[model samples]
Target: MSSVGGGEECTVTEQQLLPPPPVPRTKMGCSWLFSLRTLAAGFSLILAVLFFHPSLHSFLVGSTDPNNPFLYVRNFHVWTRRHPQKAQDLSMGSRSALAATHFQSKQTYIIIHGFLGSSTDGWILSLKDALLNREDCNVISVNWSAGSTTAEYFLIQPRVRTVGAEVGQFLSFLEDTAGLYTYQVHVIGHSLGAHAAGFVGKTLNGTLPRITGLDPAGLSFHQADSADRLHHSDAVFVDVIHTHGCYTFLKMWEDCFGIDENLGDADFWPNGGERQPACEDGGDGATSVKDGSSCDHGMAYVLYIESIKYMPSSTHFLARQCPSWKHYNNRSCPCGHPVQYMGFNADPRAHGVFYLNTSRTAPYGLLDSDCSAGAFSLVQIIGLMMLSILLVLLLLLVGLVLIQQYFGLPILARVRARLYMEDLVWHGLGKSPSTHILNSDKAVDT
Candidate 1:
């Protein structure tokens, strides 16, 4: 209180001097403290949390296990039926789906067909067979609104949720039932089917998804609008087979809205982006995606499965393991030994040739954003710690502004705010908690 020379005294309420008590101190049975010592302890806890549970609580939350990616995933199936109503939801009848079920390596496939397509469309069988023949994959040729409409149109129409839902179920089967933990799963879709593949890859829950859209359906009504929903924009192995652009290289390159714009990868385009008038113009009205016989939309999968040989990295394109199983500079198998491709055929369509070439390997982890497990997880945990610490500090400083509002010891509340209640309580109750105080002056005698 201040006294005026004119004989008037100014009185100040204790309320204005302190802030509110912290919640940690108010809990009925919980102990709270407000002192420099407690702050030191709280700081120590932050370090301990980071050091102890680095995998779960630290930044490594979604980290990948390089030695064994299969640890958390289950095997993925190729062809399976969903609830009947599920098909109708997307205005699509369950065109029969067929996928080869075999896993020689960690590779898996989720293949899709185009509009008005059935399991029999271009290279459908060959693609499945080729992928299955590999020691790595279990290929699934998903059937979703095969011919109903352009993905741009149907993806937005409320009914597409049916396809989305079924795709979600398929992914669940891999995670929950199949135990597809450690291996890599690749997705392949042609045209609208390609979009569906994108959706499946985008919607996958736990493990990151790898996708290869074979001549992705034209238009962005769906891909761009529902980007985060399905397409990661940066997904790995997102290939687009431009057999549709064979003849009119310029046209294919110019069609920004359809075949040309979304090839997803540069090297895999028609003619390797080189012009081939003979193949494109051989048939009348040929070299256009809509033209059926000119090897437009129909032949993409055909060439993919039947002809195109791959560079070692192209295994990602077919959602299959490279026959040789060698990755990155022909590194030997983990046992410090090399795996042989007895029937390694470089000819992609030769089925069992020695050497061949096609698409390039996808940028690592492009398909699944979380595939960089260790790095991503580390970042996540660090972020969480920062958030937790920031909250603790906020509570302490803010609590000081309103300390007198509660009946508890105000200074004790401030100290407790600096210490995360979890760490404090876990360490056990304080000694002589009954001596806790309100202010620096009040604590001196305690």
Candidate 2:
């Protein structure tokens, strides 16, 4: 009886040790579902924070004060030939004195730098140097760094109009106080600054002389109206360089730069307007600046700077008028009369789109000399050599056939007879009749 009780106790203990029957699958599934739900919620929370952060920051710290110089006109500085290094600050109210002193009636070049750029950008300064070196003109480098230096493109985009209005006001002041005229003014701008230049031109009483837009920023301005963005009607003559204009898949940053549409009277599309030579690589457009991989966006200013530098050079930077890049590459487009040049030398009279090829490096201008002439010449030489060789081969073949037909058969028959006689003599076998007769005579003599 005691042994039976011990067995029962052991059985109970083993049953306990053997784990309770597996939990129901439904219960286990519910636990897993709960865990997944928690994870999803956490992920959603993170996404929400990321999405709202910029807006929240803008709402909290954005400037509201009307008198703030950084937000308005005080930040725009004018750099001329006389004061290349030192910038003359022209506010809305107090520009008459500065204009009288520095403004000239000659051609006035107002250069406005793009987003995250200042009057001191290398390209701007280089352009100023180039312009001053060539002609006696007033090259004013508009410094709106305070408005342009923001990381948020949206924040800075709206401020462009304010900067442009200030530029217009300054131009008006120059016109009233100094001897400056609207016709003498030439506004050159890059990216966002291009639109600002357009605004400046629009605000003037009459159209300005010209406006050269270097890869005008497409972001907010791409779909914007003529009054808001750069347009051909903004100036008497508007010229645009479209460097990085095509929409790139998976590259949202690139889409925000460079206007793809034809906003100017003459639009120059160099190398099909996207992925410039030597700049076909990786670059996050916002973070990686000036590393040349952004060459597609930066090439416009680079070409412009070179154009200004080499303006006086004899080589005419020729371009072919093409309906599209396909025609340009296919060589279907002819170099027509009333030749047009790209960049600063671009003829105002030249209407419609122009296409051209450029070297990847500096001195980007290509000479009017035909690019395909060398290739064509090489092909011609090769063709001529091939034709000469083919002719020679044909002549040799004809000569051999002629020799076979005229003389080879007779020679072959003579050689075969001589061989037969030699064989007969050597083998002491059957001989020709003449040889046999001769042998017979020899035997008789013997």
Candidate 3:
């Protein structure tokens, strides 16, 4: 039989030996991809919704049983009934508080709550009580559709202008009225509120001014250039007090809050503030520490009352605007520790000496929180600083070690093994039958 020619058509068996072509790749469509992305986004939304309403977390997850669907339907109704705000009163306050104030002059505090915080939650009543007691300070609590109460959210140009306008009106009111005291426009925010204060201070630049960042939030994010991150020159002194959990964490207070600059002879921190472990009765009713310390974010009111150190000048104290003090040649709080800015004309900066280094201390403070022993604790302060530095260093070393082990060591080991195996192969070349067999095969092919 004639064999198949070299370049000619294959025999019947040859055609059968060849594999069939792969099925044509389905021409892809955007529908499934689009649907997948949509599903992912929807899932993210669900997570957000669940976080917003933690109470409904368990009920929302579907169960396998047939009756579970009906059960969930019934439970959904029950959930709506139980938590009125979730179902009822949902968007009631969107624009409701927008114009709630009687006049535009009422300065808005816009207390931005911290992480996992709401206006109603986290020192709302206490903060309100403190500000309200001061009749001089007009307040408005800002609540947003999104829960993030950071300065990034609340201190936008629009909000800044709105707040500035309100403060301007209030300033006008103070000026127009005969008996009304002069209002310099201020804000006292805790944690995230501190960031909001910084944002507003930056936004206002000149008019809407004065912010007291009580322990200031986002310390870690802005530790290197805390002042730059919180550019609040508008306010007199961003009177900062480090007493919260974040402050003491890894010396964040010293690193971020400029406690070093403002501590003013207080080598230690929480000068005149409460000590945590010492506050055995705990934060419950123990508003202030026994040795008479201030805990949590107690800057303006708490520090001033206990006769803590007043900021040296505008260089450091953001809440207390010093240029105004210098330009006006007004010693608003010249001699008073934790100087109190009664109205516009106040200067306790030059007025007071560092309480830790000074003998002068008063019985009461600017705000409601106690200020008995408003001196920085040397032991606690020193320990925190050292601890924070050590922790940061330790973390850096650990990262380096991990890099060496996970990335460097494996590559080095592989290279060493390769070199060793190569040397062995080269040395054993004469003894290898496979190499000989390969040489013979090559000779035959040639």
Candidate No. with top TM-score: 2
* lDDT (Cα, tens digit) per residue for candidate 3, span 1-446: 24565556644667687999898645465677878999999999988886555344423342223432221111110011122222112111123322332223444344544433444543554455444444434444444213332334333212322332333343343335423232445654555445545655555453444555555444443443433433335454444444442335676644333222331111112323223222334323245312121333433334433332332232112122232223223435222234333212234242222221111122222231222223234666788899999999999867767877877655544446557556657887644776566557547745
The C-alpha local distance difference test score for the whole of candidate 3 amounts to 0.39
Q: Over the stretch 1-446, how does candidate 1's per-residue lDDT look in tens digits?
A: 78989788989899977999776645533434455568889999876875566343222222243422222111122432222111211111112321123222346566655555554443565566565555444555554422432334443333333344455565554555446643366666666566666555555542443455565555433335645233434244344555443324455333432344433422244333222232343432132223253344554554455433333432322222222423321532121111111111121221211111232221211221212212224556788899999999999867765665565556765556546444555677433353242233345745
Q: Estimate each model's TM-score.
A: 0.39, 0.63, 0.38
Ranking by lDDT: 2, 1, 3
lDDT of 1: 0.42
Model 3 residue 102 lDDT score: 23
- Taken over the whole model, the C-alpha lDDT of each candidate is 0.42, 0.73, 0.39
RMSD of 3: 38.8
Clash count of each predicted structure: 50, 0, 36
